[model samples]
Target: MASRPSISLWFVMAADLATVVWMYTVGSWLDHTSKFTATSTLGGHHILVLVLAALAFATLAVLALITDGFTNTTPRLSLIKNLACILSVVALTGLVALILASLLSRIVFGRLRP
Candidate 1:
């Protein structure tokens, strides 16, 4: 008989799905707003790249989590999981910083009108 998957696995799957949905939502919003000006378009493009990077890191984290879950005996899998976690944190940090900077620029420069 097959064993059931772990609860952690379910959580990871849900988080990944949420990330994809969020990426789609943000991309749609950016596409709509980017037509306002060259600066907004440029900022939107940068934001899209950061979002994609975060998603990629999140994917890597999920893969590592799954691999380590299945083969907990291996030291290599542990290393991969650790690396993925670290990279995911870094990606998230960069994404947040980029977003804050974009918002601040828009506010200070009065570009928020668009």
Candidate 2:
């Protein structure tokens, strides 16, 4: 029988999705707003880069989690797998930070930082 996802997993997925959306939306807003007094910092290329970067990082995090789910008896592979675990933690933490900052700014400043 197929098992349902744990509540923690559901929360993790929701937070990750929220962060990705926030990063892109805020990045785009900032890019556009910069045009008024400053040169457009994040133009189309920059937006693409930010989006791709977030996706890449998030993918790496997911892959890391999946890889850790395996159990094997190889030292070299274990080392690489451990590294993936570390990278995943870092990526997830960064994403969370970005989201928190965005949320706080919206709540306190009443603007989306654009």
Candidate 3:
């Protein structure tokens, strides 16, 4: 008998593709703005690719949460599910903190007092 693809796997692939597309499109647009600096040809491409790949992996991590068998059912042979939850929470919280910091930096760009 042939095995079918798990829902989690499908979502993971989808998420990865979405992340790459989103990162590529947005990064390209951001690159066009004069305000954004790309120090070198290699550095610019590397930065964009690195950011997109990280987002893609994060998408996979999140898919693990949404998959029914992975999150709803108890693991019979391991503690991977429990670990996933903990790691996912930490990753999400860190992302939130980073976003807040970015916003704060933008708002305070010209207001820091000596």
User: Number of clashes in model 2?
Assistant: 0
Candidate 1, residue 28: the lDDT equals 50
CA lDDT, every model vs. true structure: 0.49, 0.46, 0.44
Which candidate gets the maximum lDDT versus the true structure? 1
Of 1 and 3, the candidate ahead on TM-score is 1
Residue pairs of candidate 2 with colliding backbone atoms: none
Q: Compared to the true structure, candidate 3 yields what TM-score?
A: 0.31
Scored against the true structure, residue 99 in model 3 reaches a CA lDDT of 55
- Report the C-alpha displacement of residue 89, candidate 3, in angstroms: 12
TM-score of each: 0.38, 0.33, 0.31
Off by over 4 Å in 2: 1-69, 100-114
Candidate 2, 61: how far from true, in Å?
9.9
lDDT of 2: 0.46
Q: Candidate 2's residue-wise lDDT over 11-98, tens digit each?
A: 4444545545655567556445544311222232334434544554465455446544233224654565446444334435544544
lDDT score, residue 50, model 3?
A: 36
Model 1 ranges off by over 4 Å: 1-13, 28-71, 94-114
